[model samples]
Target: MYKYLFFLTASAVPGAALAQDSTEDALAEILAAQDATGPAEQPADNGGEQITIADQLVPSITVTANGLGTDIRNTGQAVTVIDREELVSIQGADPTRALQRVPGVSFSRNGPAGAFTGVNLRGAGSEQVLVLIDGVPVADPSSPAGGFDFGSLLTGTVSKIDVLRGSNSTIWGSDAIGGVIDISTRADTGMQGSLELGSRGTAFASALAGVSEDDFYVGLTGSWYETDGFSSAASGTEEDGFSQIAVGVTAFYDIADSLELSGHLNMSEGLLDIDGFPAPNFTLADTAETQKTLRYWGDIGLTYYGADLTLRARYSRADTDRSNRADTGTLSFESKGQMERADLRGEYRLVGGLSAAFGYDYQRNQYETSFDSFAQANIQGAYVQLGWVLGKLAVHAGGRIDDHDFFGSETSFGGDVSYGLKDDWRLRASFGEGFKAPSLFQLFSDYGNRDLQPELSTSFDLGIEKGQRGTGTHFALSGFRRDSEDLIDFVFCTGLLPSPCSPGQFGTYDNTERARAQGIEAEAGIDVVGTLRISGVYSFVDAEDRMTGLELARRPRHFGTLFADWEAGFGLSLGADLRIVGDSFNDAGNFTQIDGYELLDLRAAMPFGDNLEVFGRVENVFDIEYETVSGYGTAGRGVFAGVRAQM
Candidate 1:
């Protein structure tokens, strides 16, 4: 019978090739670069007819993330999803280059008034990563260093962005250490809308209508953005930066039939212009830093389920008022912050494919920064999670315990496992532990250092996967290792009219008995024909510092990205992208290094008659000159054209 069950399941799986070569070789390079009768596909806007995100593994219902109204493939971890039609087919001007299309995600630009953009996950760093909205915690609790500026947020009513890489610190606790990114809001179904205008002095627009019969639902959004000044010379022509505005609204209802309710509100304003660079004194010139940012957010939620109980509760609010170099009378600064959160979670399924969840969360972080001191801090926490499943095997565990009257208590935990070995083959494993507590501007910020602590982690992973269904193809291969302990370093602060102690003075943000990292990751998704779609990802990181072995400042050892799309039924559509970057070193006074680049992008989509649609794009399409940091040279050979309408 099937060769004795395929040789008794290959002799009871021994070593299973120790995670490497499961054959398929990136699915034979997308079925040998398939063709098999192309064109006839166009479904992608989240609910592409039958749905996608690669079918979310089958199963439904998810509530405000991790509060677990359950069923998102029973939540076993190792998740990656990006919808909203792949987020406007990214060509960047914002939203962190649309998250660099995942896979070892990386981004950094240090300047341009949007002030710093560094989001790294997998290869960690960026304050060990941890960002969530719609589920609370939007980073920056007087953040003196813990990443999460998220490229000045506000993607104008975003839709989806859930990239949970690793070390989840149990169920998301303590900055999750190097993982947890959930940016949600956008489920208007229909009555959707969008508008546009562009190029350096750009004019942009956004809108999504709303209406839902019975069990009420509401939606509304507003956006506007502007940009000017880029004459390259490394963007220094007496530099300039400005323009931005945002407004948002969301609502959901369903009082019974398994009760449901939701709420959200947003506001944003921006005006920035920082043209820095040209320091190291040559009679100082090339300066400009005048910025403003005002933001506000709110949320509320409740959910309940049946067939073994499930529940959730949430409340959140955020406020930010920021100012910098206030027209530079010499040097001036201002920062204001406020965050409030109340979380209550629960889950239960105790039988068969087991499940469990625990709750209780509260946070209050206050801020007041102005360089020479005016700080704040106050944090609180609690968390719990447990899950398991049989039939295709699955398991997950979580924990979060935190306290910070001022950089004190901390706790984190995580676990995961998966197996399906058939119906397309699958196998996975995980181990996680993370922590980071010490902020108030690094314990008193503004050159604060009251003897800091808390920064620990341990991680491990393994993977394998194969695709199924109507052929096409799907693939995954992985490897990772992370080790860190008290490894939070930043020393060398001296002051004497700005000499900040010259020798790691107030620079006491210590913690580094050891630090390490290792990696290898790959991804592939394809459908290749009759609708055409292809995806790719690659990452290789060494990440360093076992005591200044270096490679840790702005880390980068290798990266990758390749994309393709073609939708046709006659209306026509085509898209392409290629990005590869490697080589990096900057930190530890290496004298600067940031070179190793390649970029290409293209797009074409037409439909101008049924609900209007038009497209044109060519970004860096061989713009070849690059630098993501170090003299910051990014943006060359740019062009954009747009039109998208839906009725």
Candidate 2:
């Protein structure tokens, strides 16, 4: 299952349309950048019937697996693609809500919207997963774990998300011990916008507009969101408020028939009211604390498309500035993080049914905080993959080598195979090795240690599927296992760390943890009839600490989703989603328990003419009470409604 975040917008490039008939066609159209020479041939249409929302909800093309657009069916790895249609259906102001629908994935939020959020894939730590936004790694180097915050990512600004589950360091490099999340912003040649109002005094608005000429295209997008949220603390009286503003611009120009130049810029600023432990009790409680964040990322690139070869070179950068303030308006904490990267990559179609893809990237990460001085690290990585297809069999093999300024050289390998059988059945298997380097905050902070080694992991999976998405009945069963060593955790100054403990230090980072996770994921969907569809997913994960033989924190053993959708008469659609989660522990020691819960949501959308639509949803229909994290408050029943326009 794939998931993504908030808001809506318009096209930025001539070939950046979200609606494409095929992966190859979409890539060719965007890369060509102009119609002076000719446009890519369109696929043959089947009658005059328009594509259904169901078809658009489950994307079939993947770009994260091989670093290029390819049919998902050909890839043996476990992958999920959530398209714009699905994003819109969820109608969540925060994108993390939609991620719950995916199997083998779970998330915990410290409070309400704009709070600290962490996502786990297949039982991997949040920091072990790599996140890419528009092809740029955007993890905050200033964070202790160097993890991406899902809470900050809103909807509408994102159009599609590709999730590859399992260790994938061979293709994505460090911080991929769990998996990878690739996010793409909306792109289309049109004007579109949406406005929504929901419970808790929540409001959201977004707009996008762009034009495409014969040789050039440019567009602008923006969104604003604010909400007077419920108390973040389980025992609190004051309401916390959150607000954000985001904007983006994209441009492309055709340099020649086979070459193009492109550029993009995006920025988001957010203010969040948080809860903190105050004096007196020094326990989890509400306090007048606020966090302000500003994030910016952009890239400029050149591409060359040949008959049998394609090449791309790009430069990109991501920066994040954050500050926390207390009730007295005094700054409590401040941090800055930056990453600059340059890369060159290409793919060549060799003779027969074999192809090769190779790339090299160099990046520098810098982090600074109020207490900690500026610290920086450099990394250089190179990788290559080979793919071969023969009749009913497809195979992909790849390797990556990364050189970190402090961690030395690390090599990773990954491969997968897919084989077809009769009656539209397929079998797939994959194996991968992954590693994660220590973060700057972990290596240079006041409680840091420089002698920590990188975390290492190995993972494997096998699956069998019947039928394909979009056309009709589709079901898949997969099993996976992952083992991790040298996991870095905070250790008190007990004199057991690899490095000498400094005086007056409360704790230091050390690589002294190991863990294992194994699970089964099953998903099935069927077109019960021409106008109705039903789908369900279930995940069973057994994750535990190797040393203590205890279950990992916040990782549930059972979770699943049951969903149904109906295309009603008069251009109206109705859907229902039921999410179930089992009990879980809140701490590594398994001292506290979190009870299981179930939630149901109902949604409806109706089209008004060809350019407008109205939508609404009833979240937590039963007003279920639960907590993903112990001592935190979860949202109650809420109603939200919105209007959308496109041209």
Candidate 3:
């Protein structure tokens, strides 16, 4: 099952390899030669036990940190991993809730679940981040910023999530000026299911089943969720509603002893009741408006393993369609976007501690809207990296060149190094260059600008860590800085043709901004006693426009999370977590202020039988009132309960 995971991710991530049975031993020896931490065994898929702080400290293999499945502490980048157990303990369909606990990460939403949600990493804007699911890039090409919306991503059958902070365009191509978030779904065999009911008429149910043979494996998963949410307007009285259904399939088949084929498909549909300014008032108020969305993405690939070489070829596609209707059921707006990519990648181990990884890829993006007929763009890129290890030191250096339909050619370079020290302490440093091309909506839509250039950035970070996972004490601290230029922003027209703007244009896009983001991130965990564990994460970020020196909108300067879990008697466990966010400006101009807030959550679970467990949680125990976006209503106190069964 783990080998199949490598097959699916290797092509997309660029350095991963499909390992044979003895590959683990070889990898351990390589690590031992470098004097880095040893690889920890993978955890059970869906155990009923609570995820202790020490569980997160365990040094697991991370494919996102580097191109290969390197030990987390052996990589130079700041990385976090949330496994299946932590995801279950978080206990919600929304994964962002758990993501917020990671250092150097924050999020904001217009309202409740199913609303427009955006995530920022290390002070970088949401648009600068790259998101992938099952090795497929799922950002919407029709969006104004070419970014992924986290609102619709539910934790149904997901197994693991990897977050790599800092610029990584050398490995991930484009839109990685900030970082990368990789989501992996279940590919292991067996059966697992969960059912839950919550406040505000909320209900959710999900099921996953798989079968494995001597040479092949196949899995199926499905989920449904619905909720009567509160109004999106802060002072509105009406109640909004949301519902969605998702389904997926994963398969892997072994052809020869060292050859395999793999494929994955996922589809979802959602309907959400949204509140908007209505009629003569035109202020922030409740109105009868709704949105319908259909999204699906998939990929198919083949892999081959040899004596010292591993190769993979794959093709993937993502599509999203959305429509909005008014109170009278009249179509107000509609849009559709599609992204398709094909690539081939290879990994070769030359000697004991020397290796080479290379890949080439082509991507096409197209979008159509009710107002604008259609637009399309294409890009071709190739990259190569060299990894070397010499007693107590390891480094990876890479570069990429890309040709865009409009922008011609651009190149990026990056490298990272990790040095192991005495007593389980490691020092790491990295530097990277990144770029993001203009989105289709920004270049060809009604407000488009043909003269715009791609956004560019340079990032650097340094950190030190002590102890690996499963250890009694573990901590990591890092500082990073990113400088960006040629950022695209909307410019309102002065209504003067041939002078202030294009004719008949109300607004246009232009490269008009320069920005900088610098921050410090710290994380620590400890096993206090035999059955108690504690963990905490904190970040301090200063994000601003270089020209105006004004803080970016909705990005807090200080934010952190604290967690505690205890294993009680009789197969019972209890946990508590607290989240704190400092004040910040609501807009880029620093005109309005959004106050700071804190939330406390409590959870508990116990085994009912051999394969059955019951769990419950209380969110926002104090019913704190706050808004991430101005005038957007947020959820108050809520309680939820669920049951899980696994075999």
Candidate 4:
């Protein structure tokens, strides 16, 4: 299945290898300059001299939430940034665990570790949220929903994660109905390694090595994890195990003072046990089944930075392969998917306090399954954005046009306004449009609908924020609404007298649903003492089908989180957090209701020296019995400890 991509990569390797000598020379020079500058400085502790809350805020150089590299505080969109320090403090094994605390975001997992997990943002399904790694889309085309599996993504090498809420189809072509999650890998010039052991017979290890200089940089990271996890079936006592290995590499070289070339490669492989059903009516059996997945992506790009303008051109390719095997070790299902993309973007400072950005992107997607032959599609998109700042007011607007091989064309537009008030207060509002074309499987498979229209959505939000820069206090309140149209679903044709299905066919896909979601989101944080801090977030969502007036499945109407952290002297810190999920229906008809639950987590860390630290955490402190998915078992109380070293 990967023959084409393998050959393409092989053909390009020689060229990259031929340039290795020059690259090494550049790297050596950069390393020397870095050494001369001395080692990087450690971040300042909050216990030291008091700093303004503004100074303590995350940096403003994010490029994902907005096309322009603007400060998040200045943008009129709801955004969350999780840096490396936060990840370490949370002690989460994967990205999904860390993201659960974010407002307006919820996850439904089938079972324990390595289970199939789905993320729902702002009441939108997993397929409506876009996932990116270093600005490259990573959805699996072979999957029914064409979404990325968050359970497979570990956080060992991640340096930053950005969550941009609401529709962003103007900037991202498709699958941006709910939001976007962009992940950035580490690029620090140092070495870091960690080893961990925990309950459920789990073991994990990771290593990172990187170096940076004045004009060149290179980094590599690798991690391995394995666990004898609990059974996935609700009534099963047999254990289900999982294992995974991942590696990533990144490099950059400056060909000239203003021109630079960069490349990144990421690969992961995993095997997981899944539960199978013996009968149809919601009964989960202990039948053994396993799945193996292999995923990889690589990107190479060149950028030219000038005093008034920046231009970049890049190409990327991603591929995924999956095989499902029965207890007898016979393959039952297999699928392969691949994506290739090329983008050319430019940002220009049109005038004082004003900027413009324009870009063109081309993509090709291909997928194949054991039951069907290969299928492919091509898409081309162009977008333009304008940003203007006048005094304390900022305005941004953008539009995009996408032409798909099968769907014809789609146009999306968005605009935002933000105004600063007195004393660090701000008012903001934004509106955006989103659209998602039918996936390849939905269009060409046996149960496909080639005449289906794209899913469409319009979203709006308004908010106000206040911050006390001097006292480490912050508060934000926001309200959002979204209307989705032409949602696709599979229906049994036998029910209809004049059935559209063939004689033996059971069902076919159709655009037969509409939905609306509205909610309020609130967040607050304050420092009560010198080194103690408390924070909380609450969300209320009313997500339902417009026609049936029934609540959406798996989306809780109310959810919230509260956390406290204390940094005592002697390089020791302790933290605790509580997550609350309200009751939700497990089925579309509002039957089979799932009860609400709350979980408490505790963590502690101690630093032995400047470069080494020991950390431990306890999840589900009360050993509560719960299930995120119907008829599935969840993990009980578990303890984990790990040691980390960096230089």
lDDT of 4 by residue, 1-647 (tens): 00000001100010000000011111111111011111111123345332322232233334555565555555788887777788889985666667876789888877767777788889998888887766556787788768666766677767667787898889888888988877766655689998889999988787888776555667888888888999989789888887888887878776876677877787878888888876565478676888888878777877775556667777888788889888889999998888899887777767656778788889998999999789998889999988776666777899999998887999999988878787778898999999888888888888886777789999999999887211378888999999999998888986776555655668987888999999999888899998999988889999999989999999999988888889988879999989999999999999898899999999999999899999999999999998788889999999999999988
Cα-based lDDT for every prediction? 0.59, 0.77, 0.77, 0.74
Could you tell me every candidate's TM-score relative to the true structure?
A: 0.30, 0.91, 0.91, 0.90
Could you give candidate 1's per-residue lDDT for residues 1-647 as a string of tens digits? 00000000000000000000001011101111010111111112332132222232211222222434333333344556665566676633366555766777887665442545667787677767776665546555554564566544545456656676777655656766677776664544466455555556555556666665555556666666566745323645655555666666667565765555666666777766665435475332356555666767666666554435545566777666666663454546676666777766655556555557776667776777676355556666677766666665666677778887756777777777766665556777777888867666666664566656778888877877676211368777778888887866665555334432324455555564566778877888788677887888888888777776777766777888888887788877888878888878756555688877878788786877877777767777876877776665456666777676766
What would the per-residue lDDT of candidate 3 be over residues 349-411, giving only the tens digit for each residue? 777777787778899999998988898999989988887776667888999999999888989
- In model 4, which runs have C-alpha deviations exceeding 4 angstroms? 1-58, 279-282, 468-471, 495-504
Predicted candidate 2 versus true structure: per-residue lDDT over 216-293, tens digit per residue: 668788888889988889788788888888888877776776676777777878888988899999998989988888
Better of 2 and 4 by lDDT: 2
Candidate closer to the true structure by lDDT (higher is better), 3 or 4: 3
Between prediction 3 and prediction 4, the one with superior TM-score is: 3
Please identify which of the two predictions, 2 or 4, would achieve the higher TM-score against the true structure.
2
Per-prediction backbone clash count: 15, 10, 2, 1
